[model samples]
Target: MTRSESPDLSVRQRLHPSSPFFNAARHLKKLILPAIVVFLVAQAASWERWLFLFVVPSILYEIYRFFTVRFHFATGEMVVRDGWLFNNERHIPFERIQNIDFTQTLLQRWCGVAEVRLQTASGQEPEAVLRVLAVPVVEEMRRRVFEFGEQAGAEVPPDLTTGWESREREFEVEDDGSPSPAPVSDRLLLHLPPAALMKLGLIKNRGLGLVLAGMGLAWEFDLWERFDFVEKVRPWFSDATWQRIVLLVAGTVLAGFACLLLFSLVWTFFRLYDFRLTRHGDDFRLQCGMTTRLSATVPLHRIQFVSVQETVLHRAMGAVSLQVETAGGKSEGEENASMSRRWFAPLVTPGQLTDLVAEIRPGLSLEGLDWQGLDAVGRRRLRRRALFLALLLSAGLALLFRPWGGLAIAILVPYALLHSAREGMFLAFSHFAGGIAYRSGAFTRRTSVTFHDKSQVISLHESPFDRRYAMASLHVDTAGAGTAGHRIQIPYLSRGVAKSLGEELATQAEQAAFRWS
Candidate 1:
């Protein structure tokens, strides 16, 4: 049933009957260890078998929730009433609903249902998550939400994405002197083929998590003992010939490194397979994943911050990753959310960065802006600070190891000086008519941009050391910028400049951002 017309929305509707099962399944991961604990304890005491009593209620609670939860699309708001006993009723305004996305696991896809997630700028979690809904119902909900949004005069940002300069896209104007929304083309922004994904897997180096998983599996299944890893390898080190020893050692190291790279590649593929990003007016849709397909739409206006991230490896490969921090998408710390945002455009070439950034936020450019760097005093301060840290480290090591500890000074001092010198070149900040941008990191460069219209708070931060050197950090804070995995923070500016910039941005934000509410 489409179930999406005006009359269908006016009355309260229960989630699909399968919702209770999906809700139960969502909690299964949390219950795994506890089930194991109960089962093991049952072997000792028959009374412990009753612990399933605890497990039963936890599993069946969602059944109660299924019976209780009721949602209605009301005038200008979606009202969700849940938990008959505790009784929570939420009226989420339509305009504030930033995204209405769908996620379908393999099982859900099989069941012909999907989880419906509604999000706002309030927090990391989705404002409302309907455990499971029929595919048609979910589609209807999404359509109605956006339809109501447009009816309320929510204008889609024109040319906010790519193809802006070459094209002028307007609403389909009606003969009655009213503009109606048109079906905009889903302009393909970027798509990752397998070759590029493999390259990204190499550059991203996500093998650590895989390595840890391998170790856990080995521990769990007693694979270490099964293979006799230690005892088998001991003979190569103990009694093998010098040439044989070298060969075995080389072989072992190569095998381990190869496994690590392979794991990284596999992990990247699982997470980023068939990655496609498309833009339809202000909304940018990201679809990815090999097994569990996800379709997420991020509106342009909700985007609070944007960042270009590059590691040393990425730079060497002449590539970078583009990340967008929407007003609220997902928590930065969450693996799933982090992955989606992190790989927003996992592999971007220098040529793509400018056009891509311009699409995300019009008038924001990476090229030929009046960039300012940390001057000589700031450089000296960073060097001196590094040298001081090195000295303390050397002194501590010398006290501990006596003679060999002084060798640390030789290694650390030069490294510190080199690092400071590199920062002098790479670390810079620019404040222009469009927005404020910061370029930081000597080895792992990051360039972040936030427009004045997006800036929420402007402040200057100074430590005692900063005060001593007359240096401070100016931060242009926006809503959810912290969780977006980037910030518009320009460090090591002269105190005067920091204050001036802070005041300037604050004034600009007040004038531009105040209209939003």
Candidate 2:
């Protein structure tokens, strides 16, 4: 059991002295790179060599930060005092803190220190960053924060808390040959072994991305001419026969694909080695990576929604990826994809889906929820859109191939209608138990859900097409929705029903307490 009383909050703490070294290392390029123009002028004017020290300003600033910054806890919150000339003090409430992440780069690990990031709602970056702290101290800070939060009616059950620490754990190691720095709770939900990681690499085949990276690397090193890459390939166009050219191109493409796949596998192995997800009281903690270790905690109450993704390959392997959105941090854009993907339990099977879902939001499940499918108007609209696409394709082909291409419409219309029928059949949504769910796509399926407690805005949107068809789209937006992945929007509802549903959702949201509460 955790103490309701604060844990030694009286004493102020300073960051580890090694913070400057890490700071300097981060800006090593700026610190070490000489200004060619400045040096030339200095030499011409016969100025003293000490002027060069200006380039090391970043390193010196880091040294200044080492002496100036201090932090401590007070009045159910954490306070940080930083700088002298630009003295800044921030007071962050423990309850408002949505996520906590710890990062240990290779250098930080060697020095037995980790960087801690405290994130609040709405901002794109962490609210407070503690540069470098000893492993034990960092763990203690995390423990106190969660313990205090749990006491403040965060609704983490006492029974659940008891279950975590009492369970067994898989082995974890540290640079000092001690246990993992976090002193993690023992309710390990998922662990990714090498075999499973290999499957993930193949499933998310980012081989095409390798082509761009290869081009960039070649340009960076100016290796094209030295390798005679262009000259070597000229014969494929100028000297080779048509059959020989086709064979060469096919062979080269196949070889390149294989090479890229192999590279992706190796890269995935390094990036996601020793992945583990554990429960720490009401929070889920994910720890992974090889060269640069990462530990992130998402409180159960902070989760705005959960999404399940199953591409064609995922179905073939009987696997599905689960992602959750919290208050801030990775709620949008590229950072959203990069940060959220790391949380996916790479090897999760179909049978494991329900259990995992329940673990995050107790009693929540994708199965057994009453799903509503597209209505007659919705299906007709979808078919109309498909027909429009068919007409465009037929017209483009007709322009290219005259009368023969005009015959393409006969085949295109039937195929388009059939595909649209399938699309309409699959589009579904359900609202129940103070929560909303939406499912979209035919081939690559995506399902997302959010509860009223976390719901921010309920919008009834109508486009020109929607108006023409007497239909509307009901969008349920949440606090931490990321682009594309966090889709709670249910489209193609009859306008009247859409209006009613939107009103009900808005009323429910108004009555509900804030998620953090």
Candidate of highest TM-score = 1
Q: Extract clashing residue pairs from model 1.
A: none
Candidate 1 Cα deviation (angstroms), residue 231: 6.5
lDDT of 2 by residue, 1-517 (tens): 2224453555778889889888778775443333433343454444635665664887898889889888887767787888898878777888888878788887788888998888888567667888898876786677677778668755554332221122222232433467654443447788888987888888777766758865775675455765588998897689778999899889999998898888778777876777777776777777777877777777777878888888888888888888877766654345323343346566687767788888977788789789999878788888998999999999999989997998899999998998898779888999888688888876678888888888888999999978987888999888767633657888889888899999999988889976663
Candidate 1 stretches with Cα past 4 Å from truth are: 1-10, 30-57, 152-184, 212-236, 241-250, 329-332, 336-340, 391-410, 515-517
Itemize residue pairs with steric clashes in candidate 2: none
The local distance difference test score of model 1 is 0.74
Per-residue lDDT of 355 in model 1: 77
| lDDT for residue 298 in candidate 1, whole number 0-100 | 71
Model 1: lowest-lDDT 10 consecutive positions:
159-168
Q: After superposition, how far is residue 331 of candidate 1 from its true place, in Å?
A: 4.8
TM for every model, in the order presented, reads 0.81, 0.79
